[model samples]
Target: MTQAEGGLRARKKRETRAALAEAALRLALEKGPDNVTVEEIAEAADVSVRTFFNYFPHKEHAILGRNPEHIERALDRMREAPAEESPLTTMRFIVHDVLRDLEGEGELSRRGELIMASPHLLYQLMLSSFEDERQLTEALAERMGEPATSVRPALIVSASGAACRVAMERHKADPDRPIRELVDEGFQLLAEGIDPGFRVVPTKGHP
Candidate 1:
């Protein structure tokens, strides 16, 4: 296809994906995920069910679409980042960049509200976060270009991942708050340090 045609096709695909996501979000918020069938979503999107499958591997995936890809894109964006940027800074770049995509369209806020409306969708978001974390850690490790077993890369990833998760959960709980401010707070908390025992706890009635 000519360059112009290729651009048009890309735009069409983006539109299709957006439409499907919007439909799924609306139905999820309106009826609940269990009640919203893939067929209904496809119909709402103005596409055949087959086209829906073509875009998303499963119904839940349609809701998680582009999230991981957004992280990968941010990772790619900093391929030539200056050496002066700390690992925390690089992670902040990725965090903000991924969020930028979401807020660029009211779609992020809408879909986020949808996820809150459905338990299944909330689980899907958690699963998506795990996958995205794995992909992101591995990408950062590879960028570090050191042994996978190295402590520095692992530590960087663990710290960043924990910080980011806290940031996300805070936003989910309060969409009205500034996402960037939350992320900064998360990273600051990391810098201040979490309690070593925070990851584990005693049984009830025990010290």
Candidate 2:
């Protein structure tokens, strides 16, 4: 096939995938996820069930609208980060940028609410979070010139994920506060090494 044909085909596939995901989320919000079916979502999106399955493995995935391509795009952005920046710093910037973009879209709260309302969806989201962490670990390893098997990369990625999760949870509690600000605060704590209740004793008579 010609390059133009391939490009057009890819764009059409993306449109179909997005339409299905949007339909799934809208239906779930309107009638609850437990009440929505793959057939219904496909019909709402004007696509066949077969096409929906091609984009999402199941109803939960469709409702969550988790796209693997998003991870690839994030990895690309991380790769473009300044060479002098530490991996954690690059990750912080990426997370902040991602949250800022989502804030603009105004769907984060609704998505969080939907996931929180569904136990099965929450479990699936946790599973996907682990996978994202693994992919991030590998990307950080490459960025830092370390072997993919290195423990440091995994530790960094896990810590970063934990920090971000905490930040998001706090944001959910008080959503009036800007999520990006909370994310920045979380990353700052991570940068500080998160010493557990450790306090330095002043040198005797030094002050």
Candidate 3:
């Protein structure tokens, strides 16, 4: 195919994939996931069942649409990071970049809502998160010139992942508040040694 034609074809495929995912998420939200079917999702997206299958293995995957390509791209960025950058700075930049890229049209917030609404999706998200964490640790260790088994990379990944989780939870709780701001606050907390001082209030019945 000509370059122009190839570009058009790629755009079309992306649109189709997005349509299928949007349809699946919408239908799942309207009628519980258990009540939604692949055929219904295909019809909603105006694509054949075969086309849906070509993009995703099943309905739940379609609804979640957690793109493996996105993680690959993040790993690529990590691998190509500047030699002089510290591991923490590299991670902060990479995390913010991924968040901004994925937050298009508030899609991340919508996905957060869907995940919270469905137990199966939540479980899938947890699985995906673990995998992402594994890949990130490996890439980070390479960046740090250390082995994948190094405790330094693992600790950095665990701490940053915790920051991101808190940010996501805050976004889910108050979606109107910008997710980027929440994430920035999370990183700020980390920068401050995660020791923002506040005395704990004693419960009424227990001192």
Candidate 4:
């Protein structure tokens, strides 16, 4: 009931969630996602199966290490952007803030590789991303003083998601390249407006 007690409880919960996710990723790496089970993950993390369910709805989420709080934090940051800033500018800030933390985390690259190797995990990740985009659309609409059903908000959020996805794919291909640079370039292209039919021209007789 005391503030200290509540804080301790929250911290413990986070520790449990993180332990479960780490165990899940380890098991997934050794046995693949299809071979890992909730019971095994819980046992590995020293938690009960019920506790694992409390942290993650399914094993894929644990393997992906998807944190719902990150989405909420990004939404909060986007909503706080200056009213004078354009939506794209606000989005750029949000994307950078959310992903910058991953720069030094080597585990993220490993997780990305694991996800890419499994078709089912990739599908689950895509579904989770779509849900995050939907939440972001709603938040953006609120900040823009528009209805959630408005076309512009949906368009902006969807476009931003697509750009981020492309950047991530490129990062996966070349881990040496800084992901932040790719993400920035993707947002820059969005800000500059890409020509729908734009194509590269061949030099000399190269065509």
Estimate TM-scores for all models: 0.81, 0.84, 0.83, 0.87
Query: Going through the candidates in order, what is the number of backbone clashes in each?
Result: 0, 0, 0, 0
lDDT tens readout by residue for model 3, 87-146: 777778878877876666346777777777778887877777788989999989888889
For model 3, the superposed segments whose C-alpha errors exceed 4 Å read 195-207
Candidate 4 ranges beyond 4 A from true positions: 101-106, 196-207
lDDT of each: 0.73, 0.82, 0.82, 0.85
Candidate 4 residue pairs in clash (backbone atoms < 3 Å): none
* Poorly placed runs, candidate 1 (over 4 Å): 172-176, 195-207
Pairs that collide, model 3:
none
The window of 10 residues in a row where model 3 has the poorest summed lDDT is 101-110
Tens digits of per-residue lDDT for model 1 on 81-103?
66777666787777777777777
lDDT of 2 by residue, 1-207 (tens): 999999999999878877887888889999998999999999999988998889999999888877777778778877888898988887887676666655554566677678876888888988988998888888889988999999998988888777777766787788887667777787888788678688887898875
Residue 126 Cα positional deviation in candidate 4, in Å, after optimal superposition: 1.5
Compare candidates 1 and 3 on lDDT and give the better one: 3
What 10-residue stretch in candidate 2 is worst by lDDT? 98-107
What are the runs in model 2 whose C-alpha is more than 4 Å off? Answer: 100-106, 196-207
Give lDDT for model 4.
0.85
Per-residue lDDT, model 1, residue 94, is 76
Better of 2 and 4 by TM-score: 4
